[model samples]
Target: MSDMTMTAAVEAALPKAPFEGRHLIDGIWRGSDNGESFDRTSPSHGILVSRSARAGRAETEAAIGAARKAFDDGRWSRISGKERATLLLKVADLIEANVERMALLETLESGKPISQARGEISGAADLWRYAASLARTMHGDSHNSLGEDMLAMVLKEPIGVVSIITPWNFPFWILSQKLPFALAAGCTCVIKPSEMTPSTTVILGELLLQAGLPVGVVNIVLGFGQPVGALMAEHPDVDMVSFTGSTAVGKAIAAAASVTLKKVALELGGKNPQVVFPDADLESAADAITFGVYFNAGECCNSGSRIIVHEDIADTLVEKVVALSKKVAFGDPLNPETQVGAIISQAHQEKIAGYVKDALAAGARVKLGGAPVSHPGLPGRFFAPTVVTGVTADMAIAREEVFGPVLSVLTFRTLEEAIALTNDAAYGLSAGVWSENVHTCLAFARRAEAGTVWTNTWMDGFPEVAFGGYKQSGQGRENGHYGLEEFLEIKSVVMRVGRTRSNWVRA
Candidate 1:
């Protein structure tokens, strides 16, 4: 499509006005004390999309104080499981009801396809619902058989106030992953959404309020990491910090939170790989590989950005993947038919192009697109779907995350070689193996170092399954019951029955 035609279509779909957002502290919506604010322009449309309050140290500390008071006062932390579950379910209902509103804003701010953004928002509702179920089922253990005179009990309790920092790629969904689960576990929280995509999270705060969440139980401060996020991580009142972003930032948050010995949960970067075998379904594998790389334009932490294929079928697999990549639509995110959307920002676009350029300079071959694309009407930045061949384990493109719709192809001669190449990177977020043979799939699944392994598939996620990473990818899991446990602490109690305990001191 011509750039002008695309631009016209996108412009027609743009919202009449940008969203206005503010911090939610102690159940009240308010602007930054200094009246500071920041605006976000749609990366695809090149128009203003949101203006959010820019929080500073004072706002950050206020949010922390509110959460701390809420937790200590038992406003939410001591609530009944049934009560917490009821409120969470209401929030889930609200999320579903507002899917269209949230999704449109998300697509505008994050530059993901509208369909994908809708799916993310809808999927987030399920996370909230799953967390509600967890609230009801959460339990502790009783040691009735320990002894007649000495009985014991193991209890699970909320870990107190939590600092939740979410990323822009999946702002609403990632926040849902942490917030609802923390609430379900009886932990009050202070959230800091990525400044680039802060609207959807603010809208979520509205839903939370409508759900009748207790005052001070959930607070949000919108701003950059320096004053807002850094304070959240370092606050002594925060019992734990849950962050999802780059590995470097995760490390910094961990270090800052370490001074107080607070618990830290990080979901960081990934250079996830999908291994293709000679006996695998080439067509399915190729399609999945294309989808995996292009989904969210490859901004996902679990993105199958790299692939290790059996040397014998490497050429055939690459050919099939390139063909599929060409078929996937790429354009403005507002267009529902568009499969891959704009780059998140100009800087990120440059980063992606630089990776492909460096790979070519380092002797790698571009099987498909290797440059930026321009559409007539859209003012946003876009990159062509890229496929780089001749990628070796040692190349930066092979190990580092390009975070664009780019794929790196590496060849392996044997199962051992494929596994070695898959685990060669510092990240162990996710891995996939495509083979019809059950034994081969089992072997790969058992050996892959990633937190989640897919056989005959890629990126199939569920609220029932736990998601996270290993090694540098991250620490701690999100989703399912394990997600709820991340916000909880264990306590053991021992008691003497009927005053049967004896004193050791000679009194």
Candidate 2:
């Protein structure tokens, strides 16, 4: 179906003005106490999409206070696992029902292609369903080996008041990754979504309430990262802080939360590498590498921006990559045919372009598309799908996380050199190795320092697997049972059946 038909059908299915510019606290929509708000504009066309309330310190405190109350009062945290599971299932159903509207809002606010947005929305519903299943299976432990004299058991208790701060890119998808697990763990939360893309997340607040989540079970406070995010990180009442952003910001949040010693789960930046071996299928490797670096405009934390290839296959691989990248469509995000949409903002576009410009000045050869693409009358932030050859490990473009649609190609003479080059970077979130030989690929996968390693694949996985980083990439896992564990605290219980001990102090 056409893009217009899809959008028209979605509009017809939902009510107008679903997203309101207000904070969702205590199960109600309200304005910021400071009377501050901000306008969210479409990065695709620089048009205002919605005016969301910019919550400050007071609002942040209020949200935190409400979450704490809900948890301590047993309004949410003390609920049965089956009950929480039921609520989460309802949330998943609601999300599936409203996929069109959520996808449209995400595209309008974040400037991603409508098709990609729709996929992310559907994926979010899947995540919610998966987490709901986990909620029912959140089991503790019991040991009968203690015999009749004593009994021992381990209980998993909820870590109260989680503060979630999600990024602008993939706003709803990332939020779904963290929030559902937190809720499944029976933790009440206060969410601080990115100011650049707050509309869809705010709309989710309504869905949560409609799903029958109790008041203050999940609150969303929208604002800049400074006062809102910083305050949430440092708040003493908050038991844990879960953040998905840059390593620098993660460090700051970790340091600030250290004051209260709150549990922190960080999913940070990455300089992922995709290694193509001489024996690999060149065409498939090229296609996978193109998708690795160009998907979501390369705004992904695990984006394989570093392309390390065998010297023998370098020429043929680069040729195929250049050809495929040229065909990547860049245009209005609402258009279904546009594979590559606008950058998150103008400033980000400049940052991405600056990396390419620096590489060119450093004597790097541009295999194809080293400049930004301007679409007349669109006024959206768009960069060309870039592929640079002759990139040295010492260059900033190869070392730093550019977070753009730019791929740096570096050739390796041997398997040892390929592994060394991939591990040389400070960040190790993910890596991809392509080879027909099973032993060679398995060895490469075992040696790669990244948390996730894909053989003959770039970025492919199910939500059941654990995903996170090693070195500077991140601190904790984000999917499966590991994600649920991030928000749980272990407690041990013991009971003596046969003996009553006399106190030594009495003697």
Candidate 3:
């Protein structure tokens, strides 16, 4: 009676692998100190997929020690940027060669559509290429003028050993975002991917090895947030730490890194807003807005979950949005027709669902969907795309990052109010404004609290444009020269011909 395609079943029923995650120390893969491991399941089908290392403090120490040795030994950082770029490009080629496999793994782990995963995988490959291209361009500074006989210059160098912790939503995307830039700046790394999704990172390690990178230059350690992640954060050997996850975790990592004065770059969570003006194209806005939040099942950092619409057009836009939301077919991630896929897991589904229920309790209206779908004989944790109308600034759905297919709608009387409403949250990753007025667009773009403000778009990313957040959204930008700068530190060397110390005051 079901019309499910064979591709769907093949994807949903792929045989799982083993507990294969290992600590990549000294250019080799080794198990955790105690061989401890944990299993991760496919959220789309509720089946076991792989077991990763449950790394503890001991394994963590080995990774840190290895990184220290690599930095001290001058194997990677001492190398030229062109050589590093070559190796990085080699890695990119390997990734491009095996993108399909990586895409499938990502889809299995995150329950995102296979097509979307394919695009993400492809995008990651491009990211590596982009990093490679920028590698040769990372330059320091040259200055002279101390007493006319002195010459001074500055050198931008690696921040020493780095620890990059990525998230489940985008294992490869975030890892590539951090790794290439660090390597381009001549720093080695110890990567700890999300325990929920480690397969792609594991394979990435393999590709790096094939790319002929120096031993101990890059290490992959699998672990959760407690001992392994905590140890890596506070580890003295790790001079810098980069994380892409929740704001809560970013704060903790930042605090831990503070003890050692380590450089930390965080791409944390967001509760971004999308504003729609009365004079704007409601249809285009509706389409963009719908896809903006509902894409990736609304699990993006800049989901535009909060929509501030002009009160005059609020009613029409709501209906357009509702109708548009209903047409996004959801069933199988493999099918290109499926616009929405499964939630990450039952717990996550319930978490997003809980927000919807709480919104209803707070007198919000469910304009489209607010519950999970029922598929007989299939135990997938799938939540229908949900839209919450009549949302207030104080509501939980508006304040917190639901991180699901849930959108909270609000009304604004004018552009100033809209800007105020959008900036009311602690996040400032990205925002969108739909208006034809150039002044209005410029005003909102300048005033929006977020770092990236789109005049008439959402979720659009490029390798050249700079992106990051302010306030609680996170620290430091990713993409472009700004992104490369995040992985580097500037050190000035002052030269003086007349070396005697001279002061206005005599001792």
Candidate 4:
């Protein structure tokens, strides 16, 4: 089907007028106190989709107050783990029920392909479900090894109110990454989703209510990062802050939250590398390489934006990647055939273009697409899938996180050189290696200065595994048992038998 037909069908299936883009505070949908609002334009068509309230310090304060009150009341936090698990499961069910609507809204706002959006929706539901299971299974430990004179134990308790700041790339998915675990840990939270894509997250408020979540347990404030996100990090009542965004912003948050010494978990940016060996399956590696960087228009934190190929197959692999890049369908996000859709905004598109231009000027060659694309019906921001060759490890394009669909290629003569090139980046979130030699792949994976490594595959992993970063990329894990533990504080208790106490000068 044509892009227009697909767009019409999706809109017909899920109408958009019913959604109210506003701050969800204490279970109420209200505008900012100053009545200031901003238009949210669809990236697919550059048309106004909704007018979202521009929340500021006032709203942030209100959200913090509501979360504090809810945490203090202990209405939700005092509940049994099984009860919280039941409610979380309900949320997962509700998300699955509205999968189509959720997927459509995400695509309309973010301009990712509808197919990928659907998969994200499913992944979110699974994430919530997994968190629900953790709610019941999570427990502390008792120890009798200290001595018969004393009884000791450790208890895991909620960390009170949390301020969660999510990014725009995967609006709902990233929020799901933090929210479910926080809720499972019996903590109240206030969410600050990226202003560029706040529609679906605002829509999620109603679903939370439908799932029987208590009011003020989950509050949402919509606005730009400066006031909303900044206020959240510095709020005194907030016991912890969890953020997912650029490394620079994450650093700012860390510095701000340090004043109160609150627990902070940051999932920051990455400049991931994909290393291809001479003995690897060239075709499969090529496909994985393309998907690694191009998926979500390469606007992923752990995207394999850098490729380090062995010199022997470097030329042939570059040719294959360039050929695959040319075939990437760029059009309306609703179309199933469209591999890449509109970028988040025109400014971001220009930023990506600037990166490519700078790389070209710095003695690099554009092996494939290197410019913006203009389609007849799709009037929004769009950039072509790009690949650059002859880039050094020190180039700006090679060093910085462009966060767009632009991959830079670098050649290495030996395994040691490839490892060094991959580890040269400051950020170390993830890496991809393609090699038929198991010993070599294992050794490279062990030596790579990244949090996670994919062997012969990219971005293939389960939620049960812990995922995080090293160096400047991030601080803590985001999934598995570790993710749930991030929201809880450990308390050690010791008791004296028969009221025995050590007396020195008194008593």
Candidate 5:
């Protein structure tokens, strides 16, 4: 399809009115007590897409209080596992029923392709369903052989009120990654979604209410991180904080939560790399590399933004990857045909451009697009798919998280060198190795410092598999059975029958 046709189609699909959202506190929808508000413009369309109540200290505190009360009073925390599972399954059904609506807002607010947004929203239902299964199957351990008249048991109990903060790139998906798991563990929560992509989270709130969740079991406060997220992290009433965002912000949240010694689970930044060897299938590896760097315009924590290629095939692999990247569609997000969309904002676009510029000045060469480009009849910000060759290990572009659709190429001579280069980065969220040899794949998998290792593939995730990072990539895990355990505290109970226990003190 022509660019002009795609632009017109995107414009036609634009929402006629912005989504109006208010805070969901104590099961009631209400405006900010101080009458503060914020507006979110569609990053792909340059038009207002949502207007949300800007929560302040009062609203944040109130939400925290409500969650604390609900958890302490056992409104949700003491419910039967079957009851929680039933509620979660209903939510999953409701989410699937409203997939198109949620996907549209997500695409507009986050500038991801509408098709990808639909897939993410639709797939999020699976997370809720998986969490439901966890709710039913969750168990504790019991010891029956301690003695004839004595027994010991270990119980998994809810961690009380939790604070969940999600990022903008995959707002709905990430929230599902946390909220459902927390709920499955019988914990009440206060949520703070990124202001840039707040609408979909608000819509999730509606679905939760429609599913008949009790008051204060789930509360959402909308605003910037300074007040809304800061309060959620540090509040004395909260027992845990689960955050997904930049590494810098994760550190701040950790510091704030430390004052009260609350538990903190963070899925932070990643400068993940995909290592390619000579014996690998060049065609398949090149295609996966292209998809990895450009997916969601590379505004992802797991973006394969850098590649470590064996020097033997570096030139050939770079040629194939560049050609494949050029074929990937980049344009209006509302158009189903467009594979890549706008940058989140003009400032982010500039930041991406600045990285390429600095790399060039530092002796790197741009083999493909290295600057921002305009789309026909579109006012939104966009950066072309960029690939930089001759990038050294010390270059900022190679080491830092650019968070854009920019790929850096570096060469390694041996398997040892490849693994070393991959592990050199400060962030170790994930890594991928492409090769036909079993020894090579296993060695890379075992030696890599990342939380997840992909052999002959990239970015393939399931709700049943655990995910998180190591080192500066942040602490804790999300998804799978481990995700549910993140919101639980273990307690040990000892019982003595027939009053057989001896007393140390004289009666």
Candidate 6:
């Protein structure tokens, strides 16, 4: 009985693991210059979970320089693919061993449920293993037909130093998808994690050192976006920039990198669509839609904020969605039974609430939720699950990314209309087609303007599958062999078997 109460008390308190410290450079933890620091707040508690060093322009520059020097001086880039593969697999083993600690940190920093955090840990570990195999498979090309008796081959080499700027949402997962593959491709990186959530990133940097990565190969500059990320984006020493965030900021990064003619890969935001056909199983469709929009408190880049449903089943789907929304339990993230946790911040929660207000002002009806709940007793930043029906294609709430638990419901008639509605957005990261017919699924896959198209599945991603966006959603893939290439550059090596250039021309 005493042990059970202890568990209950732990659950009630929502005990968050602390990671109060500064940036890690050259395998050492160091504070920011001028003794500067920033607080990382938990959405579940709205209090500082940890205090980390906030890098200024000088610190950012220092990190970039350190990374450049690491790549130029260290043997990481010159290491054979087989050796790199071995180290990568070792890192994967370490991450798997420490999965619980990482998961708890993620849960505390992001206010996601602990169970979900564990799943993220597993997914991240899988990426490391995938990248390890890809390291050995990181080959360019060799050809015999280029010239008779001539040997010509291409080498995919590291693109010097890289700056990876990740956002607050999915910090661990995004960095996992990025850093492992970058290291696999023999590239050193200086990272600037989102200021809002920096605890896990800082801790993971420490873990990399423990896993045998060389000093300065992975530097952390934990600070705000404007100075830290912006300066890194335009840094001349940086060879490439891989960003995962909003499209607006991605454009700025692209512009910044263009000045130096460096490579840039962006995995930006999306107003992704979820199409529910009349023939889709309403039970499964409602469950899928509920999780699609509300997972991570609708903070995901590919969250299905816009739901385009067939007019034949619109009312029925709405009813089923309302029922499912009622069943979604919300509370402290540490509780295993809590399906929904707090939004990332109070400002973000209010931002999501404003969408519901505007949707109502635009003549849409709130099918369910559409309100905010205050837990004055609890420290977490919580918001209600909301669904707005009677939405049109052009409405701001339907078109813009709410990035909250609010979902907009709109109806369509024909296949063209459905496809047109799905394609109408300015962003196209991911999309889903809910149907039992193979023909319709194939057609949607062909026509949908998205990097990832899921048939009857929403928000499904694995380590092996390549993920990114088209157009404004951002460039490049994030997983598997495709992602490893983003951190590499190709060069052609030409050789002749028996003839010298001068001898062949003059004789």
Show the lowest summed lDDT stretch of 10 residues, model 5: 1-10
How much lDDT does each candidate structure score? 0.91, 0.87, 0.84, 0.88, 0.93, 0.83
Residue pairs clashing, model 2: none
- Model 6: which residue pairs collide? 26-216, 44-380, 45-379, 45-380
Measured by lDDT, the strongest candidate is 5
TM-score for each model? 0.98, 0.95, 0.95, 0.96, 0.98, 0.94
Which ten residues in a row are the worst by lDDT in model 1?
Answer: 1-10
What is candidate 6's lDDT per residue for 1-507, written digit by digit as tens? 110111111334434555786887776788988898877777776656778888898888888888988899866888888988888888878878887877776777788877788888777888889999898888889988966758889989998899999888888889999999999999999999888778778878867888788888999988988799989888899999999988889998899889998999999888888898988888898999989888987899889888899999999998888777777766677777776677887788888888889888989998777766754446667777788999988788988888988889989998889999999988889999998888988898899999999899888788788999877898999896788888889899988888645555574
Give the Å error, residue 118, model 1: 1.0
What's the number of clashes in each of the models?
A: 6, 0, 0, 0, 0, 4
How far out, in Å, is residue 280 in model 1?
0.3
Q: Model 6 lDDT vs. the true structure?
A: 0.83
The digit string of per-residue lDDT tens for model 5 on 329-377 reads: 8888988898888899889999999999999999999999898888776
Q: How well is each residue in 17-38 modelled by candidate 2, as lDDT tens digits?
A: 4356689988889998868788
Ranking by lDDT: 5, 1, 4, 2, 3, 6
lDDT string, candidate 3, 448-492, tens digits? 999899988778888888889999999898889998998888899
Root-mean-square deviation of candidate 3: 2.8
Candidate 6 lowest-lDDT run of ten: 1-10
lDDT tens digits, residues 106-212, model 1? 99999888999999898888999999999999999989887788789899999999999999999998998999999999999999999999999999889889889
Cα RMSD of predicted structure 4: 2.7
- Tell me the lDDT of model 2 at 458: 77
In angstroms, the error of model 3 at 158 is: 0.7
- How far in Å is the alpha carbon of 450 misplaced in model 3? 0.4
